[model samples]
Target: MSSWFEERRADKVADAEEQRRTRAFEAELRREERRKDRDEERADKAQARRDKALRKQARAARREKTLTPGNVYRKGTLLLVAMSALAAIPAQVAYFVKKSLMLLPVPFALEGAAWVMAAGVAYADERKLPAWVRWLLRAFCLSAAGFAARINYIHGSEQGALVGWGLAAVTMLGPLYFEVRQWVITLSAAISNPRQQAEERARRKHDRRRRRHHRDVAKVADRLVSAAPYGTLKPEEAWARAWAIVHGTTEPGMTPRMHAWAVKSAAALATAQQPLPLDSKTIRTRIEGRLHASAFVLPTASGTPLGMTKSAQVVTDLPPASKTREKTPVKPARRQPPAHRRSKGDALPFHPIAKTVAADTARKVTAVNGHH
Candidate 1:
């Protein structure tokens, strides 16, 4: 009985030890398999990276080969694209550089450049630009001009833009007109047949009618001048009546000089009793009488409320108001207050004539220095 119990205990101990050993071996095998998986993954990633690098190198080499001068003909489209980009690059750089130097907005300057470039391309290739391009560029230019012109006209300021645009139109359109005349002659030659001649004559007639319609605008100047009450007024008063007449209905995007002309025409006719807007002859006569007693509206072009300066408009940062106390710009020693007594009870020490002379002198000096 003792031997049988001993044998059974030994057998149980051996079985338990075997089971522990088996479990340890299985865990070790799993660890080895996991390590192999990590190594394989690392190897695969390195291989992929090498392959990608090689592919990139191959692509770069291919591009370089195709872009060589000898290969240019085979890559005509690419050549044009590159040329276009190259053409645009200088303008792009110039625009941004100008903006950085406080010249113009980058976007606006670039857009202007794009427009010029487009025009150049069309002219060089001898292709008429798409209508949309012209329309878009015109829209951009007009929008900028309209806002600036409106504000400048209303404020009766902007020495440059007003003058610049007017002068520019004169200079540019002068040559353009002659060229157009030549072009017209060429075009007319192509249509010398009787039927075509008739069409041309009708077109000319239509153009004439349109121009006449615009030209026959009321001579406001005559009305204001002859309106007796306003017409006979002092310069200040006359100017007011003239201004009122101009403002009443003359904002048809014409020059202020044109506005003055219209006012003068209207005034000349007014004494003969033309009906004014919303006012009876009696009311008009009364206002004119009052105006005549005071200063005549001196028909100064820039003196008009909505007058555009016919000069080159320069970009300047004007203060909101120049009413604050400031130091003397030249002397730098005098502290100028609001009530600066340059003249008796005149408020400020600002002399427009003096400033203008100084500015002109300075400009001339600078120009002379540049020549030197």
Candidate 2:
């Protein structure tokens, strides 16, 4: 029984040890999880900081791009124009409303007309309308502004001279400023770089000179342009075609005759530059004469000249003379006169003078041949 009790005690001790180990393992696992969570939090914080920095940098870049000089000028001008309109419109409305409520729309109508005309000027420029149209819009805009100014002057005159002048000036200022701004914009658009201007001038001068020099070709080109479908043929292409038709050559600045002359001149130049060939017979004769003048010398064992042998004499001894035969002179054969060819009209009766003339000519030809 005591031994059995000891065994139960031993089992209890082992169970306690197992519980302790399980608790330690759970604590270690919790510690590991907390470490991982902390690391993840640090990484998230670092990412957030990087994103914030990037956002700030992007914002600065955008600000720098948006604050350019041209953008400032354009926005500032628009702001000033808006303020001017606000200031001017109220004065006109006050002046007109004092007269009658029924006349309330008059102020707006006058302001609208001036602004509409101003807008029309811009539209005209955009559409590339004629200068006259743009100028007409400018005139209308100014006229409306002047009429409004006069009304303001009349209304303010009841108060005082200074007030009247101030009101009139203010009333005119908006449209006048707008018109000046438009003029400035137009002139700025029209202005070109000095070099570009010079190039344009030179091009115009060249075009004028070309038209003057090729007046006939230019006329034909103009006719072609008129005859073709609208926008179908370019001026340059028409001019090229016209040049070809007039000069009978596709090459610019050259005619067929000029080409022929150039070819002939080139051929003449090539011929002049060529070296003349030496005559073979003349060279042979010169060589033979030189050989005949010099004698072939032979030396003995002591290097002294044994004797001189004439090459001409050696040449004569090299070949034997052949036999010759005499010939008898043969008599020359007599020439026969050519036969007369009958004309197609031989069957027809001829005039006496014509027959006699023909007969005389035949006899003369035969006599000449016989004498030869």
Candidate 1 stretches greater than 4 Å from native: 73-372
lDDT (10s digit) by residue, model 1, range 135-175 = 56545544443443332232232355564454333323322
What TM-score would every model get versus the actual structure? Answer: 0.21, 0.57
Give per-residue CA lDDT, model 2, range 220-244, as digits (tens): 9999999999999999999999999
Q: What is the lDDT of residue 239 in candidate 2?
A: 93
Cα lDDT listed for each candidate = 0.50, 0.77
- The prediction achieving the highest TM-score against the true structure is 2
Question: TM-score of model 2 relative to the true fold?
Answer: 0.57
Q: State candidate 1's TM-score.
A: 0.21
Clashes of each: 62, 0
Alpha carbon lDDT at 369, candidate 1 = 56
